[model samples]
Target: MRFMFKTDYEDDIKLFPHSGYLWSYGSLLLVLMIAPFVLSSYLMSQLVFVCIYATVGVGLMILTGFTGQASLGHAAFLAIGAYTTAYLQQFGVPFIVYFLAAGVLTGIIGAMVGFPALRLQGIYLVIATISFAFIVEEILARWESVTHGNEGMRVKTIQILGTAVPRDSPAFYYLCLGVLILTIIGSLNLLRSPTGRAFVAIRDSETAARSMGINVSLYKVKSFAISAAIAGFAGCLFAHKLSFISPEMFTLQLSIEFIIVIIIGGAFSLHGAVLGAIFVVMVDPFLTFLKDDIPGVIGGLAATLGAGAQKASHIQDSVAAFASANGLKGAIYGIIIILFVLFEPLGLYGRWLKIKLFFQLFPLYKRATFKRQKIYVKSERNR
Candidate 1:
């Protein structure tokens, strides 16, 4: 029986040549490197934008995603990082040191913010965090000397480790990519360790976890601090990348966008965060192209809007306005959360697992059968 089972497993392994782990890592690396070379300037900008979002998404994954703490004011943390970097840079601090300082400072702030978690849970915690974010923004706006108010602060080319690097240079891309890779690795390692598992256990049930000897409060506060630190690191990277910082950029809307990313990508899973970033980043351009190029080819069908066609030519513009104005991303994100809550709470990663399982177990697999149920159960229990 052992020999038969071994032979069957070998056959299965041969059928699936690439391990999921290898495929995920290799694919991500290849895309990150090749994207700069293959993509146009317009696209490179979008890709850079995606990396920025991914950086924050990773942070959120650690907090709301992994530790089950919800924050709608995450952009506030990013604001803290961005402004801290800008202010420090103005005083002629070394860029790397300033960025590190931003992370540490924000980590401290995050811990303080996590104090509310002692009493609040569920949506109440969300409200507390969101309120904290707004309060911070108000301080930044009113404290003109520091945040520079609505005019914001400008950063020159960052001098890191004794080398000056321009924001838009290819070197910047490499730098952001390196930071992203390291952060992801750090997060993954943390998730696999005892402390990380303790966070997950606490997220699942603070009462139960505490009963089992886990320090629930410690983990909760630590998770917030760690998450905020990551957000701050990403914010500093954004400051350098854009070289222009503004209070307007870190509004509640931006916080909603961060949430959208994890919701669309998959909360509690690193891959989901990455994928969510990609989806949000790419969707605009994809639709823009459709609005412009598609209308040229397919606009003949909607010829009645001929005179008005030029004004409404780009579906992307109108859709984007609607999305931004009515919080389309937020609405979509909420719907996604609802759907996940109703049927597929694991998000895109869960859906991808289902697809992979179907393919791997094909031929013998029946239609509409849930092959990835165990993964969902485990992941949800961890959350």
Candidate 2:
């Protein structure tokens, strides 16, 4: 275990609090840089998705994690970015310019949503955001002239510096990784700034923040704008990565997955976003494997239970069909979210922190060190 005693105020806010962090982070970066060369093509593709999802996860982390606000419609911002990029690419606008433009447009839209949010809180805010998402989806589907409606739009290869970059190229992977790295750095810096502090203040206690002379409403709006902008940027990358876009791609299920990403990874930490993204991407194959094997397992069990071979086979086929359906993925996501909320409220990062601390302290570690504490208020007790 390494120990460092703070010698000055600056140490409190230092990005790397100790040399140990620098070494660990540097090593991780080195591994990621070489992964493309070593990993299979399928794994490389997964990593690309990890980067894209991490970008969106970080954006949600800013709004829901840092700012104590909830949005169920963030996928709408992603759709906006994706569609904007798709439209602009057809008109010969450079990727860089239109990519940033998507973020700007989505940020403006987020600010508009945030205005009504100033008067709402908790579940009300959540409902409003959900409504906003549905509205955006409707517009996208109805605006057939621009969005091509439900038929979807095909995206051309991204042009960077006058060279066409295919989505599957290593260069494209690096582009995503680069953007994700920049976003992580930017989020870390934002957290270290006064605005980030204000966000936390609002999250913890808006009344206390207001008493401290912070403009609670304004900062809330700012957080929404920043979060939406990041999501939009991620969406732009996602559009080019897939080379196809449609209204169905950005649905309520996608928004819920974003929320699940932060919840399972560690909603309050920047590292949680990346970790959650990796978890989501990496676990998908296992889920797919399970989906494929489940029918065989069911068939064998049914046969052993004295069912006729023909009946067992039919049952197995039906079960397999249902398991292979698109709803299975959504069901899995729902179960994960529920399980994480009920049992691991602090998320995977929180669990990792406990393990790290346990190792660092060794025999001195106590179970109660990480236990959740319950507060009982006299007023609520009486009620």
Candidate 3:
């Protein structure tokens, strides 16, 4: 009945918790079962967008979250994927070939970049990657023959095995959901394997990992390649979903957004990717709608209160007006990131884990300390 997974530790030095296995799988299954019924077409389409974004976010999580590499050029890899799909489709290639090719091509490019770039770390690495992102974008935008340049390209309705699936159709939503599920499950499985541990080891300390005989370079490149492949897979799906292709679709802003999703969700936790995607995409629209709709009702109430309420109405109007301007979205995201880093660096999933632990411990919660020692509980006890 417990909701959180317990981590093991040796003495005082703590390690990451491995709790929430059942809840993770169960929650996703429930969402998949009910999402079609609960979400309207507009919302469903938005959810598709979240899924695509989460796919890239998951990739970044593996690199940034697990391997401790910061990459601001993830969307560049996505662009590679999107353009690859678009170009291959133009040649009458089947959807399957295009999808696989996008992932493989990006993975190869990522590995090549990772080898040289791993020589740098921290801000320098970030700067290098950011430069790479802009470079990829410029190449895609200026290389007219291959990319069609800024003119962009339009993708036809995606047909699989000669069966066409329209963008807005429920079928397309289901397709996205299926991809999301597969990626999540695959990520979870990978994280449970030796490879995932190696990535985590490298993240914690490359020197230590090397001392422990964990092939640091191989894992580092592997992490980037894998992350790029996942991002590419997302792009393939995205090209079909949008039914159009452009460099604008893969902006630097989006690359930052992907990093935000992982940080807000919980770095290194796949579930964080899901939660962050749902939170960021869903919350923004709801906040926008509330800002637009609530003022009218508030204004009506202000009229009843007469002249004294005039001041209140003005204040409310100003606030509402500001919220509707779209600038607030960035402001809110900034605040969220600030608060999470300061108060919950592990992200929302970290907060969720704490909450679950609180309920699990009940009256004993008051004595519970947020320390490394708690991670050492028996696995049998957790189960």
Candidate 4:
């Protein structure tokens, strides 16, 4: 393992951190830059989705991860953004202008949501956000004149400057990839700023943060707006990807999926957002493989064990039916969340850190270094 000894405080704050970082990130960037050509069309489309979801994850990460706020209504902000873009595009607006409008409009609404959040925390905040989402959904459904009710509104082709970018085109993928990169960069900078520190301070202890002269309420509101704006920007892309906008698309399930993205990815780290996005998107194919292969494998085992061919065939049919059912996907997603929460709470990023440290400290690595510290709450009388 190689180490970079820092010479000064400035060295610690450098964007690259060390030469190693520059090389690693530079190589990753090179890979992404050529991915459209090197990867298949379906894979490129999934990468675009990963980029979009990662941006949304970063937005949610800002609130839940950094600011310590609970939100179950981000899907509302996403809907606002998509509808804003869709509605504006109808008037022949430029992509740059409408994109900004989606973010700005969603930001303003997010601030409104934040106002109510100041008086709430924990589960209450979660419930409030859920209510907010429901309210937004009901309004979208009832406002038939504008939202087209349940019939859904079609999103036009993305036009940057005068060039039309179809969802399937490489240009569209680049557009999303570029947006994700900008979101990550901006988030990193924000976390390094005083305002970002104030967010963390509020998250740790609002009373102590207030005593330290930080405007707790203002920063919480700011965090909400920032997170919402990012989600809104992601929604703009989500709209084009579907080429259709409907209230049903941005449901509570979508909001929960966003939360899952950050959680299973590593809720506390910026890198977790991307990792989680990749996991959430890629897991579908993995599940699809399992759906196809599990039954055959089990049946083959039964046949080898001297079971009749009819019995093996029956077992295979039953397993295949169970695996291929529509509800099975949601069940599997739930199971994954439970497993991750119980066994690997620190998430994919946390797992990667352990692997990295194992190599970095080969022959000296201890499992206890990453073990969760068990704490028991003591009664006041015992204390």
Number of the top candidate by TM-score?
Answer: 4
User: What local lDDT score does residue 250 receive in model 3, on the 0 to 100 scale?
Assistant: 79
Candidate 2 vs 4: which has more lDDT: 4
Off by over 4 Å in 1: 1-20, 286-299, 304-343, 366-383
Cα error, residue 137 of model 4, in Å, equals 1.4
TM-score of each: 0.82, 0.92, 0.86, 0.94
Q: Write the per-residue lDDT of candidate 3 for residues 148-259, one digit (tens) a residue.
A: 9988888878888789989887788888888887887788777777899899888776766777999888899999999999999998888888778887777777887888
Candidate 2 residues 1-383, lDDT tens each?
87679888899999999888889999999999999799998988899999999999999999999999999998999999999999988889998899999999999989989999999998999999999999999999999999999999999999888898888888889999999999999999999999999999888777778879999989999999999999999999999988999998999988988888899999999889988998888767977787789889999999999998999999999988887887778788878888988887788998899899999999999978977576444433442
* Model 4 worst lDDT run, 10 consecutive residues: 374-383
| Candidate 1 Cα deviation (angstroms), residue 235 | 0.4
Off by over 4 Å in 4: 2-8, 371-383
Query: CA shift at 96, candidate 4, in angstroms?
Result: 0.7
What's the lDDT for candidate 1?
0.80
Q: How does each model score on lDDT? A: 0.80, 0.90, 0.83, 0.91
Model 2 clashing residue pairs (backbone): none
TM-score order of candidates, best first?
A: 4, 2, 3, 1
List the candidate 2 regions with Cα displacement exceeding 4 Å: 297-322, 372-383
| Model 2 lDDT at residue 130 | 98
